[model samples]
Target: MIVIYGIKQQLTPIKAELSDVIHQCMQEVLGFPEDKRAHRFIPMEKEDFYYPGGRSEAYTVIEINMMAGRKVETQKKLIYTLFERIEEKIGILPIDIEITIKEQQSYQWGFRGMTGDEVNDLKYKVNV
Candidate 1:
């Protein structure tokens, strides 16, 4: 799952485009399937969303949660790909985008009434 946070005005209008670019980066870098897109957007008010210096109202934080298995190089590639693709396709510069990947053991994830490790029918590989 991917969670995106940004100021309401600067984020809402581009959610669809951002989601598509993100999913495309995921597919290109991690070999994720098209059907695996899961993005959640949180558009907050200006006062509610506080950001660091040098970033504009367009600053976005993207948090990616997934099962732990991918190699470090693969993860870095995903991050770089997202930064490049988002800037090129969605007009969000790398400096204004913050991305983090949080990975956990497969057993820690529960879906489809079963734990991730027990669900053997996944269409995509996690250990890329």
Candidate 2:
């Protein structure tokens, strides 16, 4: 799953486009399947969302959750891909984008009433 957080004023108008951009990056760099999109948007008020210096209201936080199997290089590619694609396609600058990938062992991931390792078929590669 990918969770996105940003000020409502900035993210509300472009949520769908931002989701598409993020998914494009994931599919290109992480080999995510087209049908496996899990995205959550958390749009907060200005008072509820605080950012650091040099970042405007466009600041966004993207948290990616997944099983731990992909190589470091692959993960790096995904981050850079998101940064580039989001800036190019969504008009969000790199400085305003904060992305973090949270990975756990396959045994820790529960889906389809079973853990990731217990699943028999996956449409995409986890080790990519």
Candidate 3:
């Protein structure tokens, strides 16, 4: 599963399409349907926060936190794919995006009110 949190200004024209674009990117990278994943998008107006070091011109900043039953290489590839898609869709160069991967034990995550082992077994039977 992937959770994406973004902070950007309201004046940016991409606000309307951000969530859709993110969903598409995740689907393409992870090869999974929306129902099997968890995603989060957070938007902030310009005045609500300050970008230090004169970096205010950036229209979007993406932070992705993901948990998957995949190897490191697979995780890296997924992240790269996401970045490529984001750049293509938003017309932004690959500069301000960040991604983090966390591997969790089967008992660590809860989905649909089911804890780690149950969800893992469910997804494994369905996907693996």
Candidate 4:
């Protein structure tokens, strides 16, 4: 799953496009399947969203959650791909985007009434 956070006024209009761009990057870098999209957007009001210096109101934070198996090089490629693709396709500059990948042991995730570690029918590989 991917959680995206940004100011409501700036993020509301581009949510779908942003999701598509992010999914494209994920598929390109991590070999994710076309049906594996899970994006959640958190659009906050300006008063509730505080950001670091030098970033504009368009600043966005993307947090990717997944199983801990991908190689470091693969993860880095995904980050770089996201930065490039988001900037090119969504018009959000690299400086305005912050991305973080959070990985956990498969046993820690639960879905389809089963833990991730027990799932044997995944359409995508996680150890890439």
lDDT of all predictions: 0.94, 0.93, 0.58, 0.97
User: What lDDT score goes with residue 61 in model 4?
Assistant: 100
Listed per candidate, the RMSD to the true structure in angstroms reads: 0.6, 0.7, 3.6, 0.5
Q: Which stretches of candidate 3 lie over 4 Å from their true place?
A: 1-7, 10-16, 45-56, 120-128
- Model 4 collision count: 0
The parts of candidate 2 lying over 4 Å away from their true place are: none
Candidate 4 global TM-score: 0.99
Name the candidate, 1 or 2, with the larger TM-score value. 1
Over 2-95, each residue of candidate 4 has an lDDT whose tens digit, in order, gives: 9999999999999999999999998988888999999999999999999999999999999999999999999999999999999999899999
What ranking emerges by lDDT with the best candidate at the front?
4, 1, 2, 3
lDDT by residue for model 3 over 7-114, one digit each (tens)?
454424565565667677656666657655455556666666555453335545555544446666666776787678767887655565656666666667676788
Question: Which scores higher on lDDT, 3 or 4?
Answer: 4
How much is 84 displaced in model 2, in angstroms? 0.5
What ranking emerges by TM-score with the best candidate at the front?
Answer: 4, 1, 2, 3
Comparing 1 and 4 on lDDT, the stronger one: 4
lDDT value, candidate 3, whole model: 0.58
Best by lDDT: 4
Put down candidate 2 lDDT per residue, 15-112, tens digits, no spaces. 99999998888888887789989999999999999899999899999999999999999999899989999988988999999999999999999999
lDDT of 3 at 39: 53
RMSD in angstroms between candidate 3 and the native structure over all alpha carbons: 3.6
